[model samples]
Target chain A: QQQVKQSPQSLIVQKGGISIINCAYENTAFDYFPWYQQFPGKGPALLIAIRPDVSEKKEGRFTISFNKSAKQFSLHIMDSQPGDSATYFCAAAKSGANSKLTFGKGITLSVRP
Target chain B: DAGITQSPRHKVTETGTPVTLRCHQTENHRYMYWYRQDPGHGLRLIHYSYGVKDTDKGEVSDGYSVSRSKTEDFLLTLESATSSQTSVYFCAISEGTGGHYGYTFGSGTRLTVV
Candidate 1:
């Protein structure tokens, strides 16, 4: 059922602009949400994550905004740069013994200089 | 980059042949996972192990089997490779804490079945 759904298959943004990617999850039990950055021919690496208790978290230029009631989360990249071009993924994992993380379809970001 | 290594980074095989992908981790993490990545689909967990000899199925477990005889190695076997089995496979490990919130992935193995 694709526990997590991501939007904007591809995004093209100019340098100095902001890049935003959104994700929605159907499972309310999911407590931990994380975003991953992946370059072509490489594996996904952890970027930032947020727990349900908080509404937002920021790491450098990357910001994760979560809406507990809406069951959605978003990743915002401030001051986009060409070097930031990569595929971003959002994942959801429920709190407990499962430890299984479910990921959404990725969003490819192209930050033009 | 997370102390994970997948062998046969690129492989070409004939259908009906038996092929196996190996994932090795130096972190000694308790959890190991195998996933497939495609154009539209993100990462689909094929199988995972909580401990040695304790493996379980994931969303896309069909046509694939996994084994964990040791703490740092997980093996994914394709009993009889097929064209549909062609894809990029990744292995990930989850430490109790630190860098990765969920897991850390391997470099990935690109498999092609003809």
Candidate 2:
């Protein structure tokens, strides 16, 4: 079963615009949510993450808005730039001694300058 | 940064052949994972190790086996390679159960079976 679902298979936005990608999870047991950014020929790097306790998290130009009741989370990029063009993946995992991650299909974002 | 490396960045093997992929880590993390990335499939876990000699299967573990003989090395073996198994494999390391801290991934290994 696909535990995590992400929307917008691909996206295109103008530079300095706000780019948003959303994701939903089926497992309520999930306590941690993270977003990863991957460039071509490279590994997926952690961008930002949020727990069920917080409503939102911001790191520089990237932001993660989380809704525990809705079982949903989103990644928002403010002032999106061309350098931000890449594939983004959203993942969820439960808190425990040995928890595994469940990931979404992924979204390809493009920022035109 | 967590140091993780996947060997044979790219490989092509014939059907019915045996293939082994290696994941090496320098951080000595207790958790290690193997995942395959495919178009429209996302990242599916194949196997994971919590400690030396302790391993378990993930969602998509068919046609694959894993061994963790040492704390720093995890091996993924395909007894009989198949074309359907072609995908980019990634190795990830986490200090904890991955909930507290995110995983650090390697560059990935692109494998193709013909």
Candidate 3:
């Protein structure tokens, strides 16, 4: 079973427009939610992360809105740029010493310049 | 760029042959994880090690084995290569347990089995 589910396998947005990607989880034990970005032929890098304690966390132009009760979270990128075009993965994990993260299928985002 | 490196960035091997991939880290992190990435499946953990001489299987570890002799090195071995095992493998390191601080990933190794 896929513990984390992401929507919109692919996305396209014009430069300067906002891009939104959504993900949902079934496990209430998950406490840490993180998003990773991957470029072609490279490893995935941590873009942003949020804990369940906060409803929203923002860093520069990237923001993560999380809903603990709804078991849902979304990533919003303001002023999308061509550089932001890449694959994004949403992951969730319980807080502990040996917890392993469960990742979504991932979404490919393209920004038209 | 957490000083993580994966050797043999690309490899093509024959079926039934044994293959091993290496992950080296200068960061000396406590946790090392091996993950496989396919087209439909984003990333599935095969094995992980929390300390020297300690290892555990992950979500997908049927045809794979791993070893961590030292803190700086983690080795992943395929007992016998299979066509279904053709995928990209990634190695990640975390300073703290459970990766609450996030992980640093190596470039990746693209393994193709014929």
Candidate 4:
């Protein structure tokens, strides 16, 4: 079963515009949520992450808005740029010592200059 | 940054052949994972190792087996290569500071079965 579900298989945004991608999860046991950014011919790198404790977290131009009641999380990019174009993955971690990550299908984001 | 690498970055082999992928970590992280990436399927875990000689299967463990002889190394072996198993494979390490954490992935290995 896919524990996490991400929307917008692909997205397009104008330069300096806001870009948003949403995700939802089914497993309440998962407490850690992280987003990964991947480019062609490279590995997916950690972009940003949020815990259930906080409702929102921001890092530079990237922000993560989380809602525990709805079991959803989203990544928002302020002033999106072409360099930010890539596949974004939202993942949830199964709580415990042997933490396993369950990922979504991924969203390909494109920022047009 | 976590030092993680995968060998045989690219490979091509015939069906029924045996294939093994290696993951090595220099940071000596306590966790290692093997996952395959395919279109529309996201990343499916094949197996993972919590420590040396301790391994467990993941969601997509069929047609694959794993071994962890050392804390820094993990191997995934496919006894009989098939076209269905042709995809990019990635190795990751869970880095934490005594709390919740995320994973650091290697460059990945592209394998093709003819």
Write down the TM-score of every candidate. Answer: 0.97, 0.97, 0.98, 0.96
List candidate 4 stretches off by more than 4 Å: B96-99
lDDT per residue, candidate 1, B40-97, as tens digits?
Answer: 9888889988889999999889999999999999999999999999999999998753
Model 1 DockQ vs. reference: 0.55
Task: Kindly report the interface RMSD of candidate 3, rounded to 1 decimal.
Answer: 1.0
Off by over 4 Å in 1: B97-100
Error of 2 at A27 (Å): 1.4
Fnat values, candidates in order: 0.53, 0.84, 0.63, 0.51
Model 1, A1-113: lDDT tens digits are 77899998999999999999999999998888999999999999889999989999999999999999999999999999998999999998876674688899899999998
Write model 4 residue lDDT over A1-113, tens digit each, in one string.
67799998999999999999999999888888999999988889999999989999999999999999999999999999999999999998866778788889998999999
Q: Tens digits of per-residue lDDT for model 3 on B42-85?
A: 99999999999989999999999999999999999999999999
- lDDT by residue (A17-82, candidate 3, tens digit) is 999999999999899999999999999999999999999999999999999989999999999999
Instruction: Put down candidate 2 lDDT per residue, B3-77, tens digits, no spaces.
Output: 888998999999999999999999989999999999989889999999999999999899999999999999999
lDDT of 3: 0.94
Q: How far off is residue A106 in model 4, in Å? A: 0.5
Lowest lDDT block of 10, candidate 2 chain B = B94-103
Q: Pick the candidate with the highest DockQ.
A: 2
lDDT of each: 0.91, 0.93, 0.94, 0.91
lDDT of 3 at A64: 100
